[model samples]
Target chain A: MSARLRRLWGMIRKESLQILRDPSSISIAFIMPVILLLLFGYGVSLDAKNIPLGIVIEQPDTATQSLAGAFDRSEFFHPQRFGAIQEAQQALAERRIDGILWLRNDFSSRLLSGNEAPIGVFVNGVDSNQANITKGYIQGTWLAWLQHFAVAQGRALDLPVAMEQRIWFNPALSSRLFLVPGLIAIIMTMIGSLLTAMVVAREWERGTMEALMVTPLHMGEMLAGKLIPYFALGMGGMLLSVAMALYLFDVPLLSPFWLLMLCSALFMLVSLAIGLLISIVTRNQFLAGQVALVVSFLPSFLLSGFLFDIHSMPEWVQTITYLVPARYFVAILQTLFLAGPVWPVVLVNAGAMLLMLAILTVLVVKKSYKRLD
Target chain B: MSFFHILSLARKEFLALMRDKRSRIIIIVPPIIQLFIFGFAATYDLNDVPVAVYSEDRGGASRELLARIEGSPHFSILHQISSDAEIAPLIDDRKVLLVIRLGQRFSADLQRGDPAPLQLIIDGRNSNTAMTALNYLRDVVLDFNREWQHGHGQTGPPVKLEMRAWYNENLQSRWFIVPGIVGSLMLVVTLLVTALSVAREREQGTFDQLLVTPLRPVEILIGKAIPGIVIGLLEATLIIVLMVWFFEVPLRGSIPALYLGILLFLIATVGVGLMISSIAVTQQQAILGAFLFIVPAVILSGFTTPIANMPEMVQWLTYLNPLRYFLVIVRGVTLEGDGFALLFHQFWPMAIIAAVTLILAGWLFRHRMY
Candidate 1:
């Protein structure tokens, strides 16, 4: 074997041993992903189901009862009866209920008299997303009830425009399908950056970096050695996350398995490069961890269009999202998992990630080589 | 437990934190950068959802419908496709989130007072965004339906639902998210500060030196807890100030109520951190432990997603998280103008959490001191 290859192999083996010996590294690579997947899959949902809603009816009649029953039947709402609007308002104020459906005494009378009886929907707007969803659900329930009421009264409920919504990709509209893939990117980001940053920074802090600097190992070979084990560890973590998403969460992997692996490996390289860069610069574990978190993890979590939409952000913030590596990874993962291999989307995103990997590789090599000099 | 001992230890802790200028910057700066990122970048309100239109009907009604869609702030028309084949590429590439298709008979059917089905094909990859955009589109269609009915001399639909959002009239998502960021960022900073303290000492062989001193375990715990609390308060205050002044989220409730919530929340988080520090022999374990708590706590805290939306077991699990209560307290005080009376329900849970975790941490600290 070539001396360079032997040196690289030695360093890789050393890293592997250290990783195996360290319980923290093992937990981070294996255990944390499981916990994160389970927590995010079970605990986080954008679908606001079983929202507690207050129903205020002043007049006890068949129309109001049927309307209340309509609310009761919806999977979206759990309706509670309030005698007065004031009581419902109090419940809303205390957050016991998310919204109120108030029916005045004149509701039935006004409908019978051919007047528009506007039903009041008061939503607690602290969570605007939930509030908007509640409003939409209320409107839908009320509209369906109106159509039923018209049918019961032997009148045709004809509307000029009716909507036929065909939801593609995710038919159930499950947020899990969307989030779980993006989460894989986040998990990879953490594994790739946090572990590498900490380990390399530890070497510097312990003065082993200076010891290594005197060795026959080239800076390139040294970086390669550091990158290889962590890269494999991150990919292992990624596979675990993807497996959980598939079997445990029942999120389908529409793209080819090899394709997913290839892209994930590419993104993992990008992440490791980031970790190596941060570690080389900081050379302090605490500072490196903080920098890695701020530069990689948080951006991956928040700015990568993971939980929030990119287009929804302000223009400048949207531009900033382009700089977050996980944005490309997230787009790639979401597309591959949900929409199969749509080449343009996948290729473009992969290309962006490739560009990033190239740039980060150059930076890491330059910084490490300079430090050695 | 000598108060002087605890006080001096805490001062030393503060000195260690500020001693490293970079560490000092790490404590103060990232939260602000995150504040900006979380403030401006993290939003649910869809500003311009890219849409594509395929209108087979060349009539005025379809034109009016297209115009209405174009006019709404929620949607931006990116493509006007001529053929059915174009729609596939547009959606497949995610170039457009939703495709508005007007059937060839749409205008004729509507003119004959028949219900014209306007087909909307939505990219459901991000179901939340799709659902939100669908809701907005439905509103536009509902408006068009109403206007069409009125123009044809038909009465409006009976039982019109009128929605009025309380507290936030505009329903700005920033108002909700920013205050929650305050709680979460504080938790992170406080937890990291305390989580690293004992672990750092143990790793550096200072725990033995400190143990030989006259300071009792309780005094050390108090000393450790104080710096975390102080740093947490200062960080929270900075974030809160930015949240209110810079972000323009109105601080409607009593300031004391918010501080009380922050204090209890910091204590609870610090307790969790210190517990991790006591068990962890290295800084890495402490960080991993801190992350183990932070991730689950943040996810279940109803910060981005509502607790009501979570499964029953997860919802129950959230009750143990101090962040859950702190979020309610922070968002309630800032947005809902909630006072101590309304916020009391949120306070006691965190107090209980603080008590339990601190006790556990103290015991663990003493056990590990040997």
Candidate 2:
């Protein structure tokens, strides 16, 4: 047992040395996730703000000017005056302006007299998501303006219903609250899969795995040695991510820190086991890297419900998502960060992870134990 | 160089790729599976966003508001919290994405001829989806308000919004994504396949044997690029068909024009891949180097996300990416029904990228070999 411990320790040291030597592996493990997190946090926003809108009034009347003023004051619309509606329409077609708001003559008197006044809003619906969102904003702003106007004039604006919104978990609706947890899952997966994939295949390529195989190193010990260095690295990545989430992004760590770490460590183990399976099966660094991306990164990103809600997916797809370990990890991380640890969900996820780890470890060991001859 | 010898060498390379079962599966299955999954997954259109409502008013107005919310396809009412305090736990648990709070003054505000303030609390973690949800909610509320005003003989704004969604009226994300996937899949496959091709040869000492052959540098470059281009085109065709048939994404543009654009884009990508392969000493380095380039390329290419949303500096950098131009061309032709005249903006950038990257790759190939 003592001799076996020594061999495992030696293997771990060698693996750590190889990983430390490769700058790209470290960068992929650490830097890439940070960059992605920052990008997703800042750059990629679905909420369309400061949408450039062109407004053309045929004749400048009190009503047209006030309507245009209302549009100008809107947070959603950045209203610009165009000489002609044609010019604005052209801009919309060219994807320069999202929409054009046109007010015709005698717009103000119609509002005072309580008559049907027609306002034309032309929207460029090329990108339907943006177009639909912009359309809704434009329509809502106009309706609000009219309702306020009616109330000011001592009119009975019988509002049929009013919606009371209570934002629950994240009262502030801060993007950081949800994204930070998802980011942790993504970063850990990248580190665990990319590092493990490269390390084992690299050993095979460098002719070191063969030497280790011929030695007295047991398969279990060999696997442990291979995973330990990455476990440390994965933990380091989790710490960095947690710091960023807490400090930079202002995402609250609602759950117990130990629980978060425990779940993260288990997630890392599953990811590493997956990478190990890929390495042992392929025995080539390039093939292993591709397989790691296919099995780990894509599944984590797509099936894990990181961005898209799992409930929204088709039933068959939801069933298939169970195959991905990241699905469990994403749920666990989100729960840990936002909802605090609910043991039932956490336990179930942890058990799923343990089962996956067992399966992957068995496959990797079996593949590794096969004779090269 | 004799044709017979060239064919023999090509056959040898093909056999090697075939023998590597892992590489074959990695090369083939990922693109298909990723396309199918990403086709369903990468969407901004929020479907059935879980919303919880807390109504203090319980008046006719609050019920009407709830009806409007329920009417919209975007939101699915998951639960109704009895009080405002219940909202926090629900949100924290992620049981609900949106909370609609009706204040106590809801019925009185409307009776007193004042603007009844309604509050919507959205979990803004996924800002894009939140934003969309907010917009959708606001639209429903506003429409209800407008109808109420119209019934009371109040003159509202004269302008009606006529929105015509070009490319995808149903707003199927697959319509926009399929073309992008064609470009991305081709980029990954072509780049990785060739990125390792020369490097694997170098690692096996077969590259020295190739150098000893009387084949010119241009000949070797052509040989490497041809297979990659063929494979990339094949994959593109397969993905395009799958996208159109399975996902129901429409192909509005000229097929010939689309093919032409893909041809140019593949040349640029394959050139970059060949260059990486030539410089790399081992297959490991080649794959890593390809990965380093590919990740940035995919991110900057506006595949899953929009380029316009990127920072000014990153948006500027996107001009240099061949995939960016290809994406524009593909999206333009497929969705926008754009002719060559409308697509002229895309053509030159793609041509320029192809010319520059291919030239650079060829130069690097000769430089490294010599």
TM-score of each: 0.98, 0.89
Return the DockQ of model 2: 0.40
Summarize candidate 2's per-residue lDDT along B31-111 as a digit string, tens digits: 998888777766656768898877778677778778878878888898988876787677655677888777888867765
Q: Least accurate stretch of 10 residues (summed lDDT) in model 1 chain A?
A: A364-373
How many collisions per candidate? Answer: 0, 23
Q: Write the per-residue lDDT of candidate 1 for residues B1-370, one digit (tens) a residue.
A: 7899999999999999899999999999889988997799888899778998988899999999889989999999988889988988899998899999999999999898878999999999999898899889889999999998888998778878878999999998888888888887888888888999998898888988998899998999999999999888888888888888999999899999999998889999999999999999988778778877887888889988999888889889999999999999988888889899999989999999899988998898768744
lDDT of 2 by residue, A9-74 (tens): 898998788778867667766776677666555544444668889998888876677768888898
lDDT of 2: 0.74
The stretch of ten residues in a row with the least summed lDDT in candidate 2 chain A is: A159-168
CAPRI level of candidate 2:
acceptable
- Regions more than 4 Å wrong, model 2: A34-42, A73-78, A104-113, A147-159, A164-177, A202-208, A245-258, A334-352, B1-15, B19-22, B53-68, B80-85, B101-121, B146-162, B366-370
**What does the lDDT read for residue A155 in candidate 2?**
68
